[model samples]
Target: MIALSLIPLYLVAVTLPLILAAIFGGPPRPFHQELASGLGILAFAIVLAEFVLSGRFKSVANRIGMDVTMRFHQLMARTALLFALVHPFLYQGSPSGGQRPWDPSRQLTLTTDLSALATGIAAYLLLPSLVLLSIYRTQLDYKYETWRLMHGISALLIALFLLHHTIYAGRYGAETPLTWLWVAMTAIAVGSLIYVYLIVPMKDKRQRWQVSAINRLSPRQWEVIVSPRGHSGLNYKAGQFVWLNIGHSPYSLHENPFSISSAPSSGPNVSFVIKELGDFTRSLHQVQPGTRAYLDGPYGSLTIEDRCEPGIVLVAGGVGIAPLLGIVREIRLTGDPRKVRLIYGNRTEEQILYADELADEDVTHVLTEPPQDWQGETGLIDAILLDLILPPVQVQDWLFVLCGPSAMMDTVEDYLIARGTPSGRILSERFEYD
Candidate 1:
């Protein structure tokens, strides 16, 4: 993808100018500084381009093998921070080593430069703290909401600092001709943040769903159902997810995205069968019925639309079957004549998340530890089991949707590839946290 290619392009664009500037002199020529600033701006532009092209910011980060999308975002933020600091430091024509006051450059080092120094230091300190908060978010899970709020606050602070530093240090206020340019760029950055946070969330709240019921499926799993008010049905395709905010500020950063485990035809009432994998989800049992819940998605492209051939193979492990359940439900509702086969694996027969519902379907249950009187497939869902269940259809033609742990997906992918299946035909969604 172009996003992958742009990573190296950005690296070179940002680094090459600094390399050339350092070799020339203590302070490079005006043209060199312009070139470096131009490169920095270009790198930021590329990040925006990558984000637009990929649709989601996370895709670009995932393409580059970064653990999270926030890392790439913070990387761009820090780059901007550094550039803002350096512009004032390097361009200031100040004399060093306590030279004679008669020097023209020495006049620039007056104590009146305190504003520039203060703003630069503030920006420098705040940016890295924001980056650290983003990087170690999982470890600091208890303070995730606090960290998120602080992240936004710091962004505003950095923006203000950059505005002040640029206006004062660049003398843009005195230079009436360049005043508009300074105002425009600052407005664009600040405006973008507001649009992403405030405007978008307000527009999204109109798509809220009312909670119908929350049934405990197991000690660590739940089946949550929500009915849309009036004629506003939550129209989402199978395999897509929705962001859930349970009775709080709509702008609260505490919402989590979960795949819709029921079909859109399930009418006004949409369902999400969630597992208590984290702190946020572990408290799902406490949520009362008739509570307000905001839904903000139906994102993700893992669907059966790409599948054209007969005999579809759906492989799911643990609660990863949520999305696949929606797909199966849709297929059954539409009365499609296509033969569908589901291979579901779980740690134990009792621990199978949707054992009862799955038994009613044309699915083969594979449990690691079955009860004494149990009659079903055993052991892991490996190449041997796949080969045994695979019909006479060509491996290249059949589409396989694998959603589970990364290790299991990797194993399944390798097995499929070895059996002459093209990588494109095998679509997978990693439900586990990276």
Candidate 2:
């Protein structure tokens, strides 16, 4: 419902400026000119809204998944860039000069003021560059932190430039009421950045946690556990993830998201099944057990807390088992009668984590490359293997939760839906490398 309601809020936010402008605007210009101005207003509004959409606010993430939210952010940014780029070109035939004596508002002529025009030109060029750089971030060799800093800085620059160009140079925006409206919108957008970097970090200082233990889970994976200090741990449902920062200031960029492999019913301590991957995670095994840590979530919507399904089917590949471990463990610890099954896949036996604990559950372990005398499943978890394990009845009624490599997830989700399972019953988490 929260996700569904966002559509109207989004519509109101992006269209409010255009609506107010039409009501208070002067004589209507040519159709093409009006379209150009309208697109300009919409693009600015969208750019401002992007700040909140991508700000990691719980309000957005809790409804639509984080992957969906970020994907929407990327798509909308490209859209706004398109609108901004063409808005200037569409005003082709308009005469350009200083304010005319007959037309004090310059409705018949484009502004000749260099300062106002310069801001618009700068923003027009920088906006596309920013969008392209982000789309190719992982392809570039730069550090994620460096790319992140540059992305934030570039966005702020574009917002400031557009704000100046809109207020001093825009036809509808120059009015007293519309001027304050743009000011408030821009202020809210800028304030969201401060809220993310400064305000949230300050709030995290009070809910500090201490590392309780760190142990190797596999050759390339480790488990890090932390106990809340002076507070009950996060009240998150199983399968939710948190942004973890260890042995660093709350404001540090060292934080990364990891699913809580530990169940909330398991106590006040949280455990993460982290695979050694990234600059921050690679050094996780070296983190001391007594070091202080901070967390900023319980985000993601992969939990089964409110689902009415009678059974849960968890599919995981490699370290994607992190969240599924929490969900299955919660079902066990709480003695919930709802049926549970886990299909965990890995490249080799050595890559598997918690072999003993998982063996006790109804888990079907699959390996792409099996050893000489392997007795268990020995192929990838593809459609064939899924057919062999899950009966048609189970597929139709069970709630399927999946977390894995992109290909594995896509394959499994498609197979499940094709086998008569409801689309809503299938949940997936793409382990993005951000």
Candidate 3:
């Protein structure tokens, strides 16, 4: 909840320029021109703030969840673009040129300096390209890491150009105080970039981890475990995940986030349940034990801690059971006595993993395709299945933790909400959702 609580503070930091400009700005220009300047100022501030909303901040990702933070970053970029796009057209008939001798304050004339206007023109063109590339990232052929690098570099260039243009030509930014404030704000935003690229990697050098074991969990799923070399392991709650980098240096950009399937109560060794999906995931089988590993995480807000719910209902589909297994294992390890039910669904019987290892207390295993004489629940875990698992009176107080395909999650969430379950009681982590 740290990031959720800090949202108001984040808004204040980003809107400081607007607040200061409204108070200390010079005599108002024509309505259209003033509107143009105001919109430009707001856009620049929001663009700068997008750097910190990139899901690398522990204070943000750990509290609101990385999915929420990253989604906000993507959405805000488009909003800032709309503002920047409309700004120039609003200044249609404004007087423009070098500051006139008659108008010493330049209140009547907008600057037309080649250097200032050039930066703005370049930034205006680049901003939309950056936003479009991001929105259509998956539709393109480039690797995810390549897209990520391009996104960062393009953003940095845009910020630099916008800073130069804002200070040199902006009506409010021309003032010494507002100019300095923008400089400070831009520096802070860029500082976050430095922290993620340099500082975090340097810190990882002191606390390294190495792969201790790797084993196939199912046909397409593998389990990898790592132990801290010389220190205590992560202090993460169940249902959290980390960016795991194996056989790569701390500075390498070859990491992917995976849920920590092992419970914190299971000693210093942490485990991950990874399913073969992309380039890196498919190569999990080739990874050897004792490989150098680095972790940047324990991020995500999905957890059962401090909850007053009488029981927990875990709804998992196929490999999505990874995090829920951690919660179930932890609960059993501590013997907390809270009633827990697991509703696991898979397409075929062979897809199920850890079936014998799982506790049988209210466990409902559902398979869409079953062989002859196959006993147990069959078919999709939908309304019909939910009705059998959840008693109507118990739905309001039980915590529902869901992870699966977006369709399954949406259906389960809608059903829960429709049946009197409070929104807060239904927790989910949709990191790759977008």
Candidate 4:
């Protein structure tokens, strides 16, 4: 059934280039190289629009296949560029068996044809931009938003240029199936973009959250509690996160994902404990109560409900403790008496964000520092602590949840594995961006 459904898509992917080749009189075997190229370009534009319009990039990145979707996007962009490169080479070649004295350099020198030159230049400019932006997204963090907007605009420009290039070069200005196909694809792409940019914002405004209170948890950490003003409660499981836009400046695409620190039982008021880590977070204190905020999810699979084990082990470091705290609070609220142990790690005693509250919970604290008078576990969390604390039970019967800096989680996972913990029972949540 799935294969049958994918047949039309497969046909579109494969034959679009052939149609282009035939239309352009570029390749004899394939109907038209230009028509095929047009279809390829149009199909890619549609896919790009679908991704952006559905707002699934981040969700796909974090959930369906972590880091894999990013690679796929990069691959598709490169493939589009390759198709663009092939169009000129294939079209200029002789349709007959004999070799023709056609030179690519000669074709480049002809500038009297403005449409062709524009199409070539647009293709040259846009393809490389797509590749470079996808590859260097993180490194060019400051220019990310500008590059993203430019990238979208450039994609549209490339599509328009390709359409013109096809129409003029192939002599299929009208009354061509390929022309209609191109038109339909462009309309779909444009409509999707409009909906994503316009209608989505209006819907988001109606779903906006109002800040109830912002409590200073520590010197730099704060717990921002918010609830939808004219809406019912947000149904989210423990450990899932939400992307928050505190000031709702549409131009300020500075939404950051934060774990819900408070349990869902806390009702309409969802709490996010944030530390002043970046420019956006540092400015959070200035945000007024009742300020409009946009929320984008309930993502991630780190909840305790997902685990069906006799006992649980939660390892957290710094603010990584936020989600773990939610899980703990949830367990307490439900009165689920499953044995849960926590090995909370921190750089120093002072930096431990939720020290008093964690101490009050029925959980163990493994601090990285012990004062002169202090007599709790100290130094990096290692196998020694695991051997000392972890109870004797079948490894599969216990679920280990690790949330912290990647390095800390890696170390803890390795130690747990060495101590006979089954690989399936160990789950780690990464809070960092790729």
Screening candidate 3 with a backbone cut-off below 3 angstroms (N, C-alpha, C), the clashing residue pairs are none
Q: Write the per-residue lDDT of candidate 1 for residues 1-434, one digit (tens) a residue.
A: 44457768756644443344344323333654454344433333332222222223234433432222334555565565465445435445543333245533232232356666587567667756765665677677555467657766776676567556544543222234334444554565566667656775796677666789999887777999987765577767777767777877677787776878898766678888888877678888788988888877666666776467676788898888888888888888877677778889887776677666667777888888888887889988888887887764646677888887777788888989998888667767776341
lDDT of 2 by residue, 108-189 (tens): 8878799998999999999999999988877888776687788888889999999899987888888777888888999999
lDDT (Cα atoms) of all candidates against the true structure: 0.64, 0.88, 0.87, 0.65
The most accurate candidate by lDDT is 2
TM-score of each: 0.70, 0.95, 0.94, 0.69
Regions of candidate 4 where Cα sits further than 4 Å from its true position: 1-117, 120-124, 127-195, 249-254, 360-395, 409-429
* Residue ranges of candidate 2 with Cα displaced over 4 Å: none
Q: Higher lDDT: candidate 2 or 3?
A: 2
Candidates 2 and 4, the one with greater lDDT: 2
The CA lDDT at 368 in model 2 is 88
**How many clashes (backbone N, Cα, C below 3 Å) per candidate?**
0, 0, 0, 14
Alpha-carbon RMSD to native, per candidate: 6.4, 1.7, 2.0, 6.5
Expressed as tens digits, the lDDT of each residue in 12-49 for candidate 3 is 98788988888888777788987898889989999999
Worst 10 residues of 1 by lDDT: 46-55
lDDT measured at residue 293 in model 4 versus the true structure, 0 to 100: 85
Query: Over all chains combined, what TM-score does candidate 2 have?
Result: 0.95
Residue pairs that clash (backbone atoms under 3 angstroms), model 1: none
